[model samples]
Target: MGGSGLLGLEVTRQARRAGQRVATTFHTRRPDGDAHHLDIRDRAAVIALVRAVEPAVVVNAAYLQADWATTADGGTHVALAAAATGARLVHVSSDAVFSGAAGRYDETAVPDPITPYGAAKAAAETAVKAITPAAVIARTSLIIGRGDSQHERQVHALAGGAPGALFTDDLRCPVDVGDLAAALLELASSPHAGVHHVAGAGAVSRHELGVLIARRDGLDESALPRALRAGSGLPGPADVRLDNTKTQALLTTRLRGAREFLASPLPVE
Candidate 1:
């Protein structure tokens, strides 16, 4: 569904690497080399594109712009369109679907979204599932990589010192974007349906994770600010570590932790 976003772009890259013909969508500021502009909010446009492509597999990595429209409603539109064409559907989801009231979430956990973005993602899962029961919904967590990831950007933002603090109470099992992309491509051809937790094997607070990354990347950990989460005004839960055993058992790809990935000589994906 999405062709230019982080996941979409990587999926396209890996798929092409594996020698599959590719057709992808873009939003505003179309990417170079024949990327089609797709306003998923316009259901007719979405349907037209899917019908024209008639791809064997459609992976939905589009997210978070117009949460209600692009994510929530857009996912449903893609599902309906893909379903009608009898294409296998792989929908990328988020662990934020839970309230963070608890942790170690699996496929069985009922969604209790607390934040607006989380609520929108939860809505998308609901609509996609109701319309396409056979679709695979991969609920993952914070995406971390070598370049301008949320973690790397936060580190740079705090290099000169920013306001507030890097959250120490909020926890997530950050996933390598490449591992996630690989797993999605594998599942697209499989029969895994409902929800699957695809994330890092280890759980750590954001502050802890930042410190680890800084230390591993040769940046001073002291350069980053730190604070414990203590208010309800915050957007998300205190914990959202995913149980990746299902994912591990399901695929040969191993989703390593930040410490593991950062420690590597060559960071893949």
Candidate 2:
């Protein structure tokens, strides 16, 4: 539904490139081309939109990090609407659902959220599963894009003398946005049901990721400060890696690790 966001935009683009008639949605920011303005918080509106679109497959990539109604309850609303319309659903979830207590999480690992955002995502997963047993709840980690993602932007800002250091202790398996979107589309058309871990093959700390981004963007890596997330009082997990072994086997889309994807600089436009 979030056709304006990073992953959503790529999904829409790839789907259309493959000859799929796509109908996108946005919340606050309006996206280019044909897209519906949807407030998923309103159950009635969500249902009406889904019914009007009559899509064969529904992929919800919308979520507000701080809003419970949008992340948790809104996911349920989409599931309910998708179920009512008999459309296949793929709900995007996050590794935030894990507390990093297990260090690594597989598709079968139960969620143990340590932050509010994580809890909300966990709750959404539970609701989506109950409402649509056949729906795919795809949990992912940091989504890295080509110089446009938040993490990449942050690295650039730090290189330009912005304050704050990237955490060396906070580890994640950052996936390429294109790979993730492709994987999601593949899952949408596949027989896979329930939770799936779609993430990168290699795990790297936040600081290391920042360094890779800096090098790729032609910035000075030394300018990017480094710190430990452990005593930084950050209210999130320290190391939560998604095990994409099972899901990777089911799809042809390769989820490239941050090191591999960011290994090269962006091509000149």
Give each model a TM-score: 0.94, 0.98
The whole-model lDDT of each prediction reads 0.83, 0.93
Q: Of the candidates shown, which would achieve the greatest TM-score relative to the real structure?
A: 2
For candidate 1, give the lDDT of residue 143: 87
**Candidate 2 per-residue lDDT over residues 1-269, each given as its tens digit:** 98999999999999999999999999888887779999989999999999999999999999999999999989999999999999999999999999999998899899999999999999999999999999999999999887799998899999999999999888899999999999999999999999999999989999999999988878999989999888787798999999999999899999888889989878676
**Which lDDT tens digits does candidate 1 get at residues 94-183?**
987898777778888899988888888999999888988999999998888666577777876785577656788888998888988998
Model 2 residue 167 lDDT? Answer: 92
Question: What clash pairs does model 1 have?
Answer: none
